[model samples]
Target: MADPTDLNLPEEREHVYKQQNDDVPASSLNSTPSSSWWSSLLAASGLVSPLDFAFVLFSVVYIFFLGKFAFPPQSDDPSKDPPVFKAEGIMVKTGPAFGAVLGLALPIAYIFHGVLEGDQEGIEAAVPHVFLLASQAFMDGVAYSDRFSTPIRVFMPVFFSAKKIFTLMDWVGNEFSKVCVGGGCDAAAERRVLLGRGLAVANLVFWSLDLFC
Candidate 1:
């Protein structure tokens, strides 16, 4: 016959294993749903572009830096009291709508179209400019806020607009390089090229005016 202690050893080990499992929280065991929900949300939000995400993150950090160092809690200087430029009636209404179309709607549509057409080059070309534009918009809002001074407010657009020129050049070059095979381009391809070039040129003109005028 086996010793009684040896017989009990197996049962004790089984009991200890079950106890360890029981000690874990239910939420930890069921974490799949939480992670799945986040994944679904991210997919729906069109934030899959790492470049876009990085720019957005940078904008946030820059805002925090401006608030902490550039505009600390203190009495406002008389010289920095007035804003450098203020929008008037019609501009106040149209400015944001124009920005929304240029920065958000146009880029999303272009990107989606590129994805559908399997135009990877077009998508890559557009991403940097759109990402920078989006970040610039965010920074513009922060700069316009009461927390910052006139110089800081003016600096945001000037800096971003200047930087965007280089990206816009790349975009224009990509659009222009899209050529037809066998000296015959389909209507769809022609249309895409026109639209791409038009959009790139428009941005170039707009931002140049924004920087200099």
Candidate 2:
């Protein structure tokens, strides 16, 4: 057996140790402290943004209100009123409704103007933004549903859901153009026809809900 002492062992060991130390990262020396790791991870994940959390809380509260108040109790008495609700001002009732009508009007006018002028390009450019604003206004309309006493609540959800469908179709037509090739083919044409049909159905549903119940 060779003598271990004569193998240049100490210098090689020192060189190896130096190289290993050089290669090792400084972060490995002190791990992320347990106390702050969760917070750091949350910050890095963007799980605590103000807007995100605000919307989350708002959605929860909004749904809670929906479940609590939307469907009223049935009673045998004709004299019994459904439910009474009041808001601070007429502005509350008028604002969102007017906004919805205007939002709907702008895009519709744009599209019609384009049709009349044979400017398909212009109509294509403007309609999606109109649908988005209309959706927001529709949501506002729902948020104030109880405030409007004359029309009643039966049509509210149907209208709101129609707005939702409109918004979704707009997104599919505009944002997901890559998926459908910007309505250039048969499939895209089908989608547009489907959207028109859906809008018609939504209108029917709202009117039906208003008339019967």
Tell me, by TM-score, which candidate is best. 1
Cα-based lDDT for every prediction: 0.56, 0.36
* Candidate 1 residue lDDT tens string, 101-210: 66445865887798898877887788677666655554554454446555555566666777788878888888888785335778786787788888888877776765
Query: Quick one: how many clashes does candidate 1 have?
Result: 0
How many Å off is the CA of 168 in candidate 2?
A: 6.2
Per-model TM values vs. the true structure: 0.63, 0.28
Model 2 alpha-carbon drift over 4 Å, by segment = 1-73, 76-85, 121-213
- Backbone clashes in model 1, listed as residue pairs: none
Model 1 has an lDDT value of 0.56
Candidate 1 residues lying further than 4 Å off, grouped into runs, are 1-80, 89-93
Ten consecutive residues with minimal summed lDDT in candidate 1? 3-12
Instruction: Please give the clash total of every predicted structure, in order.
Output: 0, 0
